[model samples]
Target: MSVVETLLVFAVIPLAIVLLFAVLTLLPGRAKKARYKPGQPWQYQPVWWEPHPLHGPAAGNHDDGPKAIGSSVYQEPQAIGSGHGSASHGATSHGSTSHGATAHGATSHGATAVGASAAQPAPVSAGPLGGARGTW
Candidate 1:
């Protein structure tokens, strides 16, 4: 084969291919970066970037009442008589022991109605020692 033809086949073709790839890399296409508002949620964020925990006024579409699309659903604390929950009753109660029922009295078998006041154990009165710490 002629030197020109051989050079064209081996060098010219590979050089053209490399130039074409370079041009394509520099071309501005539809793959533009998505810009997110500061402190707002983003589809892709850097590892160091932390979004705000609480939603701001411009965070999301809150037009539908107080609920937001991505915000957590907040529930008001249930009242004592709401029958929804016993959160106001302090610690959880087990077995049967209603209000006004003393701890010793409720020790009887098969009891119910353990009310809010009776569920919690009575706090011990501080003694003269004032909770002294012992080594052993």
Candidate 2:
């Protein structure tokens, strides 16, 4: 075949076909949707949905509506160890004392206690501490 015909069949036609598809793909995106810009008031209505409405705290019984999402509710922290023979901070083998204190509630210094009651777990506090923050 001639050079012009060979180049048309091997390169020019393939390049034209690729360019045609690229233009076609980009044409649809040109008709853009309305977008939010900085300093402009929002034009869309907000929507909220809860899956289990009947079982929630509001439950249609309260004068006010259901609580908003991400609202904080403060709950009193309960004591970890409550029952007898349970391990609390520095309880002895009989499980009736605390912090190296004797069974008669007398405090003792430098007393070595063994088992799970000896090691004190770190206290957990609610709310966020200053650290890394993120958003979705």
Candidate 3:
């Protein structure tokens, strides 16, 4: 065969086949679908599915209304020096002194240590709170 015919048979046919495949693969994705744009009112119907249909609002059980699920209530901020243990403040404990004994008064060497209270926790501190906060 001539050089021009051989080139056309090998290169041109394969390139045409590849271009045809690429166009066929990408054609379906080019079709437009419903899309949401910012500031535009949503036009689609909202759908909600509950695994337990009888317990949800769809079962005509609207007495309780829509209850907040896993919602947090707004709590009043406490004074920094209030010294009260509220939801926002955690109880701070001072140093705990425990000898070489377990909660059952048993020593490390299997001997009991009399008057040892390892089960009791350390007392909470009444001093001013101390912590640091920062932002970058």
Candidate 4:
């Protein structure tokens, strides 16, 4: 064969191989599954850094969001009611009043006022009057 023909054949063979591989890879199911690949069931098999005796990731770490006392869930500044393990000051965006307003009881998004004599309600008075007074 002529030198040019032989060289073309050599180069073409590898190029064809690479192009074939590229095409197959671009074709669905070769890597991540798509809707067209009906034969394959796409599943995300999570590899555990360690065995999960409790199943899923352990309770903390990347456990959704900031771990707090009452609620658990991550959410945006506005959507704090969904339950994703994050904490919110729960104060309204505008600095106003929480009066006659059930702050952290269920009316608000788990938010208590800054001086809310409730949330951090006098860690000193879990005693006689919900921390109101000494006696009746």
Error of 4 at 52 (Å): 24
List of clashing residue pairs for candidate 3: none
Off by over 4 Å in 3: 31-136
Which pairs clash (backbone N, Cα, C closer than 3 Å) in model 2?
A: none
Model 1 lDDT per residue over 8-51, tens place: 99999999999999888878664487665577676541112123
TM per candidate: 0.22, 0.25, 0.25, 0.23
Candidate 4 — what's its lDDT? 0.39
Candidate 2's TM-score reads 0.25
For each candidate in turn, give its C-alpha RMSD to the true structure in angstroms: 21.6, 22.7, 24.2, 18.8
Q: What RMSD does model 4 have?
A: 18.8
Model 4, position 69: C-alpha lDDT score:
33
Order the numbered candidates by lDDT, best leading: 2, 4, 3, 1
Q: Report the error of model 2 at residue 106, Å.
A: 77
lDDT for model 1, please: 0.38
Best by lDDT: 2
Candidate 4, residues 1-136: lDDT per residue as tens digits?
9998998899988899999999888876564635555566557422112223343223433323222333233222222342221223543344323323222222234454243332311124345665455632
How many clashes in each candidate? Answer: 5, 0, 0, 7
Please give the lDDT score at residue 42 for candidate 4. 55
Please give the TM-score that candidate 4 achieves against the real structure. 0.23
Model 1 ranges with Cα > 4 A deviation? 29-136
